[model samples]
Target: MEYLVLALKGGCMGVADIIPGVSGGTMAFITGIYDQLIDAVRSFDFEFIKKLFKLDLIGAFEGPHLRFLLPLLFGLVLAMVSVANLMHYLLGTHPVEVWALFFGLIAASIIVVGRRIGEASVSNVLIGIAGAVFSYLLVGMIPVTTPDQLWFVFLCATISICAMILPGISGAFILLLLGKYEYITGALRNPADPGNAAILLAFVGGCIVGVSLFSRVLHYFLERHHSATVSLLTGFMAGAMRKVWPWKEVLDTVTIRGKVHVLSEANVLPPAYDSSFMLALALAGAGFSGVIFLEWLSSANRG
Candidate 1:
């Protein structure tokens, strides 16, 4: 039952990962597996590699939290491969509704993370404000043109993958900011090509290097400064609300690989109350309610 639950949570993470302004880490947080996820990632360290080098198969196997990680990975990859296209279609066709749902989800996440803070110190508040402000500015920045070289792709993946594990920050959006979203996606579309395969190999290699290092840093801070860390993450989610707002005015766009990608956009108020507005509102409510239910379920599972 627990494994099944983990898989379902991973599926949710997988779904979130595909969206531009959403993060898989937020889903992990929502599902109450964020700490475990970090630990699992951190397990693949020097000790684990040493076991493999010595051909101590059992020791290598026992070093990492495979029981928890495997099922979760299964669900995450399954969702990414199986549902990615549908999600893209939805974002392209029913963007307003999709963004509305995610907006509610992120908003509720902020409340949940904020409550995790042990004390309401002035320092925590200030740190949270900094996080919020930084995130706000980050998500609102324009995408730029960047080189498509394999080395650059490796670097982008290394940096962007950090966001994949950081609650509230979007890895996909990070790639967009680095101007490699289309390049990577285009490679994904033609992965069989030699050049594409090489690009992907470099990208995956970078991700491995990234998590091996970043996970330790995150785990360390999470253990030593739980309150302050949660405060910042909460603020990050709060600031990300600007990116997920249901209504936006696209300022510039460019077509890449025959798809229109937004270069810049500004949030805007919905037009005079109407049926569309009501629909967005209702969907947002559903998303908010959904998170509340998930949190309740997660607590129950822990109990």
Candidate 2:
């Protein structure tokens, strides 16, 4: 039962990770496991290596907080492996409703994160606004391709992995911006594709380098300036809500290398008697309420 619950949470976290403008870290935060997650990741350091060499398997694992990490990472990996396909199917078949639920989840997430700021100081407020505007503009920009060179792949891995840890940024979206989303997704879908294995390996290598470097910075910020940083992250998430709005019109469908892709212009449903619109609203409301309920449950657990 415990494993099942963790897996379901992992599934939701994976769904968030796959989506643009959403963060698995944010999901971790709302689910009451963010600190534990961070500690576990931080535990994989030189001390752990020393313990490993000493043939102290229990000590090594405990040193790295494996008790917390093993289950959590199992959940996360399981979710990533499974949820993406499920989400892709749902998005393709019921784009509006799926997006509506996502919209609601983010909406409530913003509220939950916002309440963490104890006061509305000028600096914090400005930081929040800056975060919002920056994210809002970022999501609006057009994507460009990066040369698929080894160094460039490494660079993309570093940057995208850092974004993955941040609350509002999507690592996959970063790949999209770098023009590697389809490439990586293709490799995942068809591991045997020529050159795909190399590309995937490079990307993963980049992520490892990036995460190791950035986690320290994140730890510093969290320890030194906790509330301010959280406020800024909350603001970024709030701004990102624009990108995840449920309704969009397909502006164009283009074929690149024989694969068809849909490009959309974001839109809002007309305030009228359209059944689709009604359904979207209902889904959005459900999504919002669901997040709120999750927040309440998380708070109760903490208390």
Best by lDDT: 1
Q: State the lDDT at 176 in candidate 1.
A: 85
Please give the distance, in angstroms, between residue 71's alpha carbon in candidate 2 and its true position after superposition: 2.0
At residue 218, what lDDT does model 1 achieve? Answer: 90
Candidate 2 shows a clash count of 0
Tell me the deviation in Å of residue 282 in model 2: 1.5
Each candidate's root-mean-square deviation in Å?
1.8, 2.7
Candidate 1 stretches with Cα past 4 Å from truth are 187-196, 256-259
lDDT of 1 by residue, 1-303 (tens): 878988988899988877778999999998889999999999898988998999999989898999999999989867866776787679888889999999989988887778789899999999899999988988998888788888899999899889999888999889889998767766765678999889989998898888889999998898999999998998888888889999988989998767677878888999668998899999999999988998988778679
- Give candidate 2's whole-model lDDT: 0.76
lDDT of 2 by residue, 167-273 (tens): 77777777777877766665666556768778778877887677767877888888888889888888788778777877676676667678666554656665466
